[model samples]
Target chain A: MRYKVRELTDMQNSALKEIINIGVGNAATSLSKMIKHQISIDIPELRVEIIEKVPEAAGGADKVVSGVIMHVDGDINGYIMMLLSEDSAATICKAINEEEDTDIHTPMNQSMLEEIGHILAGSYISSLAEFLTLDVKISPPMQTFDMLGAIMDQILIEMSQNVECTLFFDTVFVLEGKQMEGILLTLFDPMGMDKLLGRIDEMT
Target chain B: MIIVGMADSAVAKKPEKLTTLGLGSCIGISLYDNRNCIGGMVHIMLPSVENARAKDNRAKFADTGIPDLVDSMVKQGAAKHHLTAKIAGGARMFSFSSNSNLNIGERNLAATKEVLDKLRIKTIADDTGDTYGRTIILDTETGQLTVKSAQKGEKRY
Candidate 1:
């Protein structure tokens, strides 16, 4: 049976949330180790949203951001993105490389930022696969720095061809007692999402 | 000024401006009739909708969107024969393995041209197929299109 995204039951939402909670937890741990500072991640928001509204979920359509894109394939197929505000990205970059003149737009900074995205986004998908007991492989991370709307436009266009809605997972990262917002978006194929919900139903 | 959202299109007459924000791999096609000072913009996400699993959103695909946009422009006093086109924002935001799906930027640009050709609309200028995202604006009075990007500041096409 096909499951309409809007018709998702509370139980199903909770189950999916639990799986993501685990994944986000794992990602936070890895981020902390990489930055050598205690990092706290709080994800109080997650939902399946229409493609047009997915960009708004991160903020406004025109907000500039730095992000990494990962493709999940194999038994399950979907896309995962880690979006950070310019300030947050710069902070993370500075923590990794303390060169006074290095900036986020520099080649050195770009590579470091991509590595940060790979480690965080990689752990996110791997943990979800473990919880679902599904064999999923993550593609190499693709890093981008541009308008928030532009980055999401690419993903939303891809998602719209496959599904009417996209799964949004958002969180906040606290570093050095400063709060920074993080958006982890997952856009699963329609059939894949239906299958995933079914698997979650069975496990529940 | 009117704002066009993703998978959407809009038309305007003289002195009015139409804009679309955040065009990454998606293509933004601007149609204008210099004789009538009428312009239209469509932000199409995919090349075609033949195998699309979702319900048909005409404005979301190049195949269906270009015709619909032209039809609307004609209804607003524009002559189809005089319509010229400018397109922007089919960008590959990432470099991945040779997956055609990830190469959506190129596909969208190609599809836009094919549709414009079928309609016989002359494409005067285009800024597309790069590794950056763009926001575009269309001025009906001047029939000029301005494309802006984070990497490349701004250019009028």
Candidate 2:
């Protein structure tokens, strides 16, 4: 049976929220160290739904570009994606890399995506592993810079099934006193849900 | 001198050559023959082996794209034994956590080397690794390879 947001028990809801909170905290710490600047991280607003429901949840964002995707397999199969606007990405890179100029050229743009991909995947997966006490392997992160349509097309083509669940969140990064926005999307299969719930149940 | 832009691939015959400008972590594999002067260039994006959605875009993956380039070169009278290979690109553009799984650039270089070795084609030269991008050019007429790196300038690799 497909699981919806409402189907989640109270315990499950709190567990998921805690997992995201920890992940965002780790990400903020890493960003602070890398950029050598004081940064603030906000708990991502979380929504759980089937993959097909992503568009409706995405809301009125005119475009979705500069994304990184990491696929996980073993016990469960799913994907973790971080999406950002090109402008926001440039600003973040300038802040982190200490670049005087925040121009987003092809080469610099690619490098920024690589760095962000590493941090987001690292923190998210580590938090999940710690919460579940299960070691999960992540594939190399792939960065895709394209329009919303192209991004959605690629996701649909790769996933091939609309039955999967998606966890979406928006992370606001305050770096050097400048606020930058980033979005994280985590996909989980039915099997993944079972594994996640099982682990949470053990915690209680 | 033929230039292959980003997301572009090209082939050359005797007296002609192909090149790709500015390769950052992206790999450039040159297939050439000293005798027939038939060659091609592929600037691949990722190092994916699985036939995923990118399989449709042959230029995106090394596993599928490299073979396709080889087959096309052979059809143009470039024999396996007579062919020489040269590769460049694959740089660590940024610093990240150690736990991040596959290194796409490293994987691209490794997959390219392995595929060429299996085909019994010796890699005449290569300039890979480091944290900078490169501009690569191949001369089908003379089998000369030139690599221009971002920080180090241009040189023959």
Candidate 3:
């Protein structure tokens, strides 16, 4: 038995890239407002691939700590996974809360994950909705603190054989003259791709 | 004193030993034996036996962790049928887009309940849902279990 490799067309890829660009821009705006600092986000590097290939493709990070997961449904039905180091997550949270104390042991426990999940997931979903002019509802964020392998294993279990595209962004969150780096993964269904491209075509 | 961490279990035989911690969407199981002055606890992160090979692995799934906890307790004189069970954790941590046949926390909670029922062990207390975290502690010497939640005060059983 053989399985055909599913690939996204160039037009589809470009359209999706534009959508993500808007999404990240919205996320940066939210960050800037929350931290009362100028938060800039770099253009993300996007790739479409099967779910099985995500681990190897994203295997270059030295350490992975906290993970934020959100599922978007409405013209698309796929989950988004964002990975960040503990230090980076602390920084992001500090930026959001505008805390002067940089102590990492601020009892983040689970609230940190929950709040970040809400902000980032909200930004991505809302931006996508506005750009495409569609109504979408985002569920509450769920976070997991584990190694990269464990995080990938959980994603694989939930996703089975479906092909999931991962968007890797080299996020440089600057606040108070400090910088933190993080990665974001946005997974979407093929139906989402069609709707997104359809909306883009209507605009241009 | 109460201690809750990953891959470790405690038994409280004395009433003074009050311990309970939150499980979140993770699965937590408790074991208590009155006569033998023994107790144990196990909290598993995932629901399946497949991810057992990973580094820094716990007792794997509920199926594996349940028996492992039971056997260890029995070796210390905890009778199989006499042991009482109290379980919690297994909340739907996130909503996935696929809607695939994978409800991990629910599956884990179900699997644990099934094992206890098959063994004829009575579950005296339980609090499992898609809510926040849970804290569980067992007194090894007193055979008492205490459950604590972020939203609610501590309860003893």
Candidate 4:
């Protein structure tokens, strides 16, 4: 059945938010420990947007950003993405390598960013699976620096063929109290959304 | 400047710059008539609308969108035969993309070319098939197409 975003009850929405909040909080904690620095996150904001609007909703289409994306498979199918500004990527690299002139474009730096994304996603997905009682695994990470809209358009296109709405959420993070900030986004297909809502219903 | 979003299209005359931003695995086709100084741009995600369940947005597919753009420009006083096409922004984005995500950029570009060929529209320029994203802008006054990328330097055709 095609699930419309407006049809979701407030109870389901809040429950989904609470689950996402816990998952993001756990991921944030993992990153903070890895960097050995404090990490603060904005409230996790969720949305159900048409596939085409996803790029604009995440940020401006043309805005350049560093992105690491991975597909989530198994019981649920979707994508998990990490988007960081150039400065944010630099800072994250600096925190780990503790070196000067952290060029985020270098192959080494790129993989480093991918690893960071993987670890955070691992933590987040684990918590989500544990909470929702669902089985999901993330694919290998793909990292690139490009316009935010371009980076995500391909994924959105892949999603659009089967689903009308993309269920996604964004959580902004600031690391070590610096201006370094990044966003973590999760996008799910309609079937996945239905499965998630079904699991939510069963748990309740 | 009129910004065309993904699965969107726009038609404008001279003095109005038409642009579509951040395209990946999608084709941004710009049609222009130098004599009339009129331009049209479409950001198409899919190659054809034939197989899509939702056909309301003709701008979302290359086959439907390019014709719609041409018709719009022609209606606004531009001659259909005088229209020339410049295209950009069909990139793999991720080199390792596999399975259902395979070479969609190339597919979109190929579909666009097929449609343009059928429409007898000459494609003067194309910057595509790389593993990067591009934003394209069309100058209605001069019919100049500029393709920009974050990693690659800018190019105009």
Cα lDDT tens digits for candidate 2, B28-104: 89888888888889876666648443245576567777787888888777787887789987765433344242255
10 residues in a row with least lDDT, candidate 2 chain B: B93-102
Name the 10 consecutive residues with the lowest summed lDDT in model 1 chain B: B93-102
Candidate 3 segments whose C-alpha is farther than 4 A from its true place: A1-9, A59-62, A94-109, A164-170, A202-204, B1-100, B104-157
Q: Tell me the tens digit of each residue's lDDT in model 3 across A51-114.
A: 4345445542113457677766666666666777678777766666677655543456456656
lDDT of 1 by residue, A1-204 (tens): 388778888998888888888888898899899888877788647777788877777786767888888887876777778888888888777766764544788887777777877887788878988788777788888777898888877667766766777777778888879888777677787777877888898898
In model 2 chain A, where is the ten-residue run with the lowest total lDDT?
A149-158
- Better DockQ candidate (1, 3): 1
Candidate 3, residue B87: lDDT: 83
Superposition error at A27 for model 1 (Å): 0.8
Residue by residue across B1-157, what tens digits does model 4's lDDT show? 9999989999999899999999888989999999999999999999888888777889999989999999988999999999999999888987544447678899999999999999999999989888888999999989999999998989999
Give the range of the ten consecutive residues with the poorest summed lDDT in model 3 chain A: A1-10
Off by over 4 Å in 4: B95-98
- Per-residue error (Å), model 4, residue A47: 1.6
Best by lDDT: 4
Clashing pairs in 2: none
Candidate whose DockQ is highest = 4
Runs in model 1 lying further than 4 Å from the true structure: A98-102
The candidates, ranked best first by lDDT, are: 4, 1, 2, 3
lDDT tens per residue, model 3, B12-118:
44453534333545567887887776777776655656544342334545667778778887887788888888887676545555555457767778888887887
TM-score of each: 0.93, 0.53, 0.53, 0.96
TM-score (2 decimals) of chain A in model 2: 0.85
TM-score of chain A, all candidates: 0.93, 0.85, 0.78, 0.93
Clashing pairs in 4: none
